[model samples]
Target chain A: EDKVVQSPLSLVVHEGDTVTLNCSYEVTNFRSLLWYKQEKKAPTFLFMLTSSGIEKKSGRLSSILDKKELFSILNITATQTGDSAVYLCAHLNDYKLSFGAGTTVTVRA
Target chain B: DAGITQSPRYKITETGRQVTLMCHQTWSHSYMFWYRQDLGHGLRLIYYSAAADITDKGEVPDGYVVSRSKTENFPLTLESATRSQTSVYFCASSERYGGRDGYTFGSGTRLTVV
Candidate 1:
């Protein structure tokens, strides 16, 4: 079975602080890694990392994949109170995605 | 106007009843997936379709059924609703395969079984 694990299930940080979320996986056929942010409703897409060492960035959020290490990390720089949400990591295959338990981030002002 | 949508944003049904959740996308995405979310379990895939009329089961498929007769529509049905089936069901679609672009999710349907 494909499995994805995330560390530090919950975290608290102050505004302007940087936070790093980790994700590791074990799958039969690995294709890519994805990150998502969920507030109260459906999850919104964050980043999709396919190659190693190449970081995908959008505003204050960035992510990188390490295929050799079988892991990925999502970093939030200069975080704001609006950045408080559950961050999810998923390992993708041709058919389905295996998701981690998710890291709940709480950013206080 | 060009995104995925789900109907019956909220539903309430009794145990042993039958219910169906609807999903439609306008992007002509080839892959559609159904997932259920709980408090701690995150999102667990219930079923997915590669294309029209080609459906496959996922991690949590029991007590559920799905059909993809068209590329833009995928509906999930609960044969016999149970208390354990109460969850927030989300519908997602991808342009290509699973690994290309990240999946686009619907607002989700909150189902309550009493």
Candidate 2:
């Protein structure tokens, strides 16, 4: 069975603070790791990491993957109230996705 | 619109009753998937289709049925609703399965079983 685990299930941070989310996975035929942000509705795509040590960034969010360690991390710098949402991690293998329980972040303004 | 859509944004059904959730994508992606999100489980795949008439089971598929007679539509049917089956259902599509680009998801349907 493929397993995906995320740490710090929930957190509360003030505006301008930096938060880091962690994800670790164990699976065969590994393809990629994906991150998503979910508010009250659907989850929107954040980033997809396929290579080791290569970071992908967009605006205030950044993510990197470490294939050898089988882990990935997402960083949100200068978080705002709008960044309060559940961060999800998924492992893509053999055309299927296995997701973690997710980390819920609450940004207080 | 131009993105994936799930109908019946919210639904309430009684136990033992049958209900079907509708999903449609205008992008014409080859892969479509059905998933359910719960408090602790996050998201779990129920079924998926590679194309029309190519449906397959996923992580949690029991008590659920799906058919894809058309490339743009995939519907999930619950033969008999159960309290445990109540959750937020989401429909997603991808032009290439497990490709560099990830799947695009719909707004989701909130189903409640009583």
Candidate 3:
């Protein structure tokens, strides 16, 4: 079975703080790893990492995949209230996605 | 209007009753999928269709049924609702199966079984 595990199940921090989320996966025929931010309804796309060492960044959020270690990390710098949400880590394997329990981050004002 | 949509944003039903969740996409994507989301489980695939009349089971397909007679529509039917079946269901569409671009998801339907 494909397994994806995320660390720091929950976190609370004030605005302007930097937080790092972790995700590790083990699966065959791995295609990519995707991150989704879930607030209330369906999750919205965040980032997709496919290569190792290469980083994908958007604004204050950045993510990198380490294929050799079978892990990935998402970093948020200068967090804001809007960044408070459940961060999901999903592995794309054989055209299917296996997701982790997710890290719930709460940004306090 | 241009994205995927799921009907009945919220529903409440009794156990053993039949319930159907509808999904429609205007993108004309070749691939469609149904997923259930719970607190502990982020998202689990229930069923997927590659095209019209072509459907397959996913990780959690039991107690559920799906049909894709039209390219833009894929409806998931639960023959008999159970208490454990209560969860938020999402519908997603993709131009290709597991394309690098990823899938586009609907707003989701929240189901409550009593």
Which runs in model 2 stand beyond 4 Å of their true positions? none
Error of 3 at A101 (Å): 0.9
Give a tens-digit lDDT track for model 2, residues A16-82: 9999999999997788999999998888899999999999999999999999999999999999999
Model 3, which residues run further than 4 Å from truth?
A: none
Encode model 1's per-residue lDDT on A26-78: one tens digit a residue.
98988888999999888999998889999999999999999999999999999
Comparison by DockQ, 1 against 2, better one: 2
Query: TM-score for all predictions?
Result: 0.97, 0.98, 0.98
lDDT to native, each model: 0.93, 0.94, 0.92
Clashing pairs in 3: none
Higher-ranked by TM-score: 1 or 2: 2
Q: Model 3 over residues A30-98: C-alpha lDDT tens digits?
A: 889999898877788889899999999999999999999999999999999999999999998765788
Clashes of each: 0, 0, 0
- Which pairs clash (backbone N, Cα, C closer than 3 Å) in model 2? none
DockQ of 2: 0.81
**Candidate 3 on B1-114: residue-level lDDT in tens?**
699999989999999999999999998999998989998888999999889999999999999999999999999999999999999999998888665677778999999999
State the DockQ of every prediction: 0.79, 0.81, 0.70
What's the C-alpha lDDT at position A88 in model 3?
Answer: 94
Determine the iRMS, in angstroms, of model 1: 1.2
Alpha-carbon RMSD, each predicted model: 1.1, 0.7, 0.9
**Interface RMSD after interface superposition, model 2:** 1.0
